[model samples]
Target chain A: MTTQANTDGIVYQLRDLSVNLRRRGQDRQILQSLNFEVRKRECLSIVGPSGTGKTTLLRALAGLIPVEGEITFQGQKLEGPAGDAVLVFQDYGNALLRWRTVKKNVALGIEGRIPREESRLRVDEALEIVGLQKYQDSYPWELSGGMQQRVQIARALAMKPQVLLFDEPFGSLDAMTREGLQDELLRVRSLHEATCVFITHDIDEAVYLGDRLMLLSGSPASLTYELDIPLTGTRSQISTKESAEFLRLRHQVYEQMRKAHGAAPTTE
Target chain B: MTTRTPISLTKSGIRGNRRHHDGKGVAPMIGLLPIAILLVIWQFLGNPHSVFFPLPSHWWTAIQGVEQQGNLWSSILATSLTFIESIIVAALIGTSLGIALGSIRWGGKALDPLLDFLRNLPAAALVPAAAIVLGTNTKMALVIVVLSSIWPILLNTRAEIQNLSPVLSSSIINLRLSGWHRLSVMIGSALPGILLGIRVAAPLALIVTLLAEFITNLSGVGALILSAQQNFNSAEVYALLVVAGLLALAVNSLVSAIEASVLRRHGPST
Candidate 1:
């Protein structure tokens, strides 16, 4: 286990992090003893089965919920929701301010923190990054689902936070749109060089975007497996997925997921 | 492989249908055809000498009679003044209190019973009490109107605030929006609900204002109608009733116009 006292390049350090939720007047443990370190400028993907508390872990790291164990960000204990991190939700319809235009929605995150002129420039930059410059004046509902998710990303990007937390942001999109956004997220992440914690249920997405992939399973879930992709150079949707090494790593993770779920092997 | 239809295609189709329906400029006038025909028939069948009902032609004479008495414009001015003042005061007080009660859990629970009792008390029943306390003045009339009409605005605003989406709240927290910025966003988002409440309350306020005038017998359209009835001036009584109906129509249209514009500007996409 890594020491929580190490601040160096780590954006987040968790030691035995646990979270309990109160449901129907009963205490239910959702996350149990999570130990991990999210390094700077790296995309960490957490993949799990549906309802396995992947979002709960992300929320805990973002300091949006209470944790029973130690979690520190840049050497300081995370007490609550900090200003240096921003979360992008899965539901773009509910996340983006419908009453505001694309520019205004992006400006929402920074308008209170900076002067008017600077906020406008930051909003434009964020919109430019997401390729939404042309639709800056359009309302969120006027845009397509993919575009609306991009606007959400722009809103978070405009904040220029050191850490970005995405909670299955592409889950609600169609397959083609989801693939398109996955690549866009990769480009934007590289451009900003910000640390990212992307949560998803899709194994392919987890392996594609993550610098390191972590699998979480079971009730009161904890980290079950961690793997590093050995494929070198820039990752491509077609070439990288077809490579033998990528296939091997993907198969290994799938087998581990089946094992974690206590399912019988498919072969006789 | 199944080819999925793009979502935008269906969305645009729905919008096109709405636009096609709204493009018929003469539809509203067509809807009023029955009323127009009814008025024409009444003009021909009404008896001029009838004490209970008068012909539409007697409207001019009744107008002259009220003008001759020098009470026509003054009565209108008094009623309009009370209605306008009461609505403004009610909107301000109701919105602030409603937001506070809705956003703060403890505040809402503490005031629930009191607000429930106040909401149930009929506005007409307060006229006598207000008149007794305030001595039948414009202040008493204003009080009666506001007390009766404030419930809709307060309740609607509170419900909207309480139902504010969790995503929006989380965004506010993640952005670290200050108190003023948060309030501005909240008020802007809740404008549609607040305006909806005001739309319902406006006509109710007007009715209550007139009721208060009729009960107090002070100086307004309601008082004029009451005096004309007592003196057996059938034409003037009927004329005042027509004017009251027109006033109600005007107030309703004005509120509807404002509600439409606000919803267009600040409401969620249809």
Candidate 2:
């Protein structure tokens, strides 16, 4: 076992997972015979270069993608788009049910058709977790990108799913807003302690948010390497991005992505 | 809960603030300018003594004469009742038929040619046929109005439903929203288009009513126009034309107002 999977409570085990995707006129095998296991309540970020199928692999986990793979959750054979593993797409605005109020949209993720009172309580609780209880009645279009993302998070959180999958959930936001949202997400994850798989092309975001980093190759992408981030103090957004270990991981992921892309890392 | 409420309020507040700042009031008034100008020009051009058609004042004189004779309101009442009856029945039939047509693609396709042919039939030509079937009575008037007005509403709604966004359907299906829940959320979302179809048909309703009245010789504005023209009361003819124009304007405005309210209620979420 890798030292990473050596931790407690294995939440998911993906066995020899392979995914092939076709876009436009070309068919490519993106995830080629990959094996990974996520432990209970651990936050893992999958980072890779653009066109490296980071999002595609995340979708595979969410069961949104049709792949040749076996994903088991709590030792149960998974079905397609497993409701237990909910996905939050990066386009928060589009992710939400625009017609529904924020409260109702959050309420949408609640499992099963339940009593009104129970759904209401769950909805309120989820909104509170995302710090968005105030905007419950407003529509998604009204909310800013960060707030919309919070609504998305709130909705996913409401589902009370075993796994939370984010496909670059903050990729569409501005730098400052994305940073704030990253911190907000981290705080929410810390509080809820849900198993998370976040995929992003951003090296810094992967370093900042992940417990373990996953790098991927370019075209017909495959997992390149994995690294663990060590932290010793209270991590805040601004400070952590500038932290030494964070920078090291960030640099390493950057170099790996460049190498996978067959290019030298540009001095930016 | 409390925190999210603040965000909602803040968002609406920001939107409200932006709208107030961006208020360029001239555009709306520009729309009204044409009507005001046209009314003025029309009123003058309709002068009987003048070279242009006949003064609107002359039209007013004829209107006053009809009011003097005191059959104006009664005849209008007679026509209005038939108009109302035809519209309610047509709305029900058209909306229901549209739903059925929208639900069945092949059926709609098969009927498309027939519906197109029917829609193209000139009201003037249909008058004699309807008159023969229903006789020269108010019922005949009703039939004419229904035939003329139903097609626009039925066709538009069917097209709207057929062209509904597929994204919404999949989303609802994914969520397992079936039966009543699915219809309410999914079909209800497309209400803007349905409401728009109704709004577009509103003008057709009035036009058909008038045309039907003219066809059946029923006592209405259409009959009034024919009578005036027959008696060579050009002033009365112009007056009847003006009243018809006003009625058409009122109906159109009412539909527009209704459409606006519906759009506001449905919002941009559709």
Candidate 3:
């Protein structure tokens, strides 16, 4: 377990963070003593088995829920939802304002905080980053699922927050659309270098997107494994995924997931 | 990509459905064809000398009598004024109370049974009670109108507020929207449901206003219709009934137009 002593370039420092939720009149421990440091401009992907409190952990980090221990952002303790951290929800259909146009939906995060002209400019720039400039006037329902998700991303980008929290954003998307969005996300991240905390159940997606991968496991979930990706340069869907390093990292994470699930790890 | 095809197809599908919904321009005129036919048949076959039934041609003379008596415009104006005032009051009180109750769990639970009881009390039945309590006055009429018609708006607004999506509420928090902004967004999203409630309430307001006037013998279209019936002026009664129907139709169309414009501007809920 890594201690909280390492504070250099760390954007978020979680110390003995624990979260317990009441379910069916019984208090269930969701996250227990979670300790990790998310660095600046780093994409830290949290991959775990289903119902392992991965979303809860993200929600706590975003200050959407009450937790027991210390969770600090930029050296200040996060008490509640802050403007510096924006969460992109998994259900885009409900997350994106259906009544608002794509541009207005993107502007929702910054509409009143800034001047009208500045808000419009930020919205335009965010839409441009997501390659959704042409669909600015279209409603969310009018757009495809992938495009709607991009609108959600555009909304977060428009806010220009310090940290982007994604909770299985592309989980509902089909394979082709998900792959396309994954590439688009990489492109956007490269342009706008905000620290990202992406929570997903897909091991491959975690390895593909994360600068450093964290595996959460156990009933009262805690960070069980953390590994820095060996790849240093830009990642492509085809070549990077086919590379020996990417395959090795992916296998290692899968083995850890199997071990967490109480099953004998298979080499194949 | 395969996804592109389905998206375009869905767009076209929406367009196709909209076109089907709009129908041809003559569809409305076609719908009115039956009413026109009924009027024409009545005009040709009705006898003016009948004590119970009068010819459609006698309607104009009956209206002329009402105009001569100086009650035509005044009755219409009185009825309309009561209807407008009642609806406005009902909308304000209903929406405010509904939102308040919906936002607070204890408030909703505490008032649910009382509200349901009041809602079940019929507006027509309240006419006699209101006249006895407050006497036959515009105030009593207005009170009856509001009491009977406010339920739909209140109930619908409350339901919509309760059904508000958690995602949108979370977004409001994440965006750090102020209380006013949050409220406006909440109201905006709930507008469709609120307007739907208002749509039902508006006609009911008019009906209750008329019923109150009839019971109270107050100054309105309903009183005029009642007096005509007592005087055995069958033509006048029939003419006033047609006028009431036209008034109701106009009110309904106006409300529907407002609802359509709002839904268009805000976009319907997904």
Candidate 4:
């Protein structure tokens, strides 16, 4: 797989990004003052424990929710859902149109805007990328959990977005499936040259898939720790993870996470 | 706890799973057993000399007599036609209006009180009013049936549309789907609910159709039953009543079959 990413320009720049949501007639802060920049063609993994507003942060970045501070996509203020950004939700079952065939679901984002022939080709190409070409005629539920999530990814890829926001896309999958999909995501990101912001609670996965990893934790989450992973180029699940650098980074992240959770460190 | 034999365990465990898988196919046939038994009992044991509780065979003979007079087929044809037309019209109106009201932020909520009052007015009560306005015709029957049946479809569609999953809704927006494309997706997402509404509305439509026909004395099976009663031909009355029940059964079966077949590709409704 090609590892060179054109990581010169900034794709997303957030300034003092705070998001408050109204629940049962009261405003609750879900994300506190946050600032970050995602470089082009880089995968930025945001890790946090569950219920730490990881999804809320992703939604704000996608321009799907109102926020209190400034957020810009490609230097433009995002007022609503950005046309060049697509969010692949974790709930693949709910994200897919069960009634639509795999091919049709992939074509959903581009059917009307693109020419019919072009749309068909794009759908075919996306299916090819996700290795779901065989299941094009099948409905989503007919496929396994991993395949359904691939279908969701294919749908987003067909849009040919400059940015792909994944909300723990493999969180519902089994261990083997998640590892396979992690590699698949890395390969796809390189091929598409798309900027990605992946949210997950899995430290190993974040380290494996991300170019830069940031820890988002707290009652109302904000970026608490940031690191640039030293390992690059094509990474296999076994060798890269077994490397000393990978272990050191993983240990550091684990300690930071324990600290974020307010747990006392164990005595050596 | 009692110790179970290995054979019994297999029967309850492995075989039980298979039975559960096959339950849907077998249950409907099993359900008909009681009705079949009831009919057989009535045929053999019921008093043939009774006025109101005529034997099942007498019902068949009375229906044959009506058929010999040539009114039976025409009445069946008219009632079936009216019911089918009413259902189609109601479905169209209900689906479109439901989508409209459901799409708007304030539309469904703002009109809830008015819709509640309107839908609560019974189809039977409106039959006379409709007949007077449309003059005891098929058109009037159509109106009454549509009015009564449209609610289920409308409300179900609205509720389904309004309750779209956040992820799915966000996907739609992110994909930049708008105009007819967006509306079509909305419709597809709400299709299971729309079909659910149709299933609920169909029987109600059939009932309203009969009510309009009977009250207006229009030409249909309902009229046949009315004439049979007025003439005090208890056997014919019983036969026509059987015919009405058979019609209801046919309608319910047809709607359910359609729903099942259509939703097969869509997966289970829930």
DockQ of candidate 4 against the true complex: 0.74
- Candidate 4: fnat, from 0 to 1? 0.75
Each prediction's whole-model lDDT (CA): 0.82, 0.71, 0.84, 0.85
Residue B126 miss distance in model 4 (angstroms): 1.3
Number of colliding residue pairs in each model:
0, 14, 0, 0
Clash pairs for candidate 3: none
lDDT of 4 by residue, A6-73 (tens): 42388888999999999999999999999999988889999988889999999888888999888878
Model 1: CA > 4 A from native: A1-5, A263-268, B1-30, B107-110, B267-270
**Rank order by DockQ, top first?**
4, 1, 3, 2
Q: Is candidate 2 or candidate 3 better by TM-score?
A: 3
Candidate with best lDDT? 4
Per-residue accuracy of model 3 over A4-39 as CA lDDT, tens digit each: 455557889999999999899999999999889899
- Candidate 4 — which residues are off by over 4 angstroms? A1-8, A264-268, B1-30, B107-109, B268-270
Error of 3 at B254 (Å): 1.2
Best by DockQ: 4
Q: Per-residue lDDT of A1-268 in model 2, one digit per residue for the tens?
A: 2223443488777888888888797877888877888877878888776677787787777666678878776666556656677777776654566667899888775535888888899899888988888889888877787998899888878777777888888887898898888888888887787899988877777778888878777566777888888865767886887788788877787778777777754322
Give TM-scores for every candidate, taking all chains together and pairing residue i with residue i.
0.90, 0.74, 0.88, 0.91
- Of 2 and 3, the candidate ahead on lDDT is 3
lDDT of 2 by residue, B70-153 (tens): 878887777668767877777777766776787686855688678878877887788899888778887777777788878756
Candidate 3 accuracy as lDDT? 0.84
Q: What DockQ results for candidate 3?
A: 0.50
**Candidates' RMSD to native:** 6.4, 8.1, 6.4, 7.2
**Chain A (candidate 1) TM-score to true chain A:** 0.95
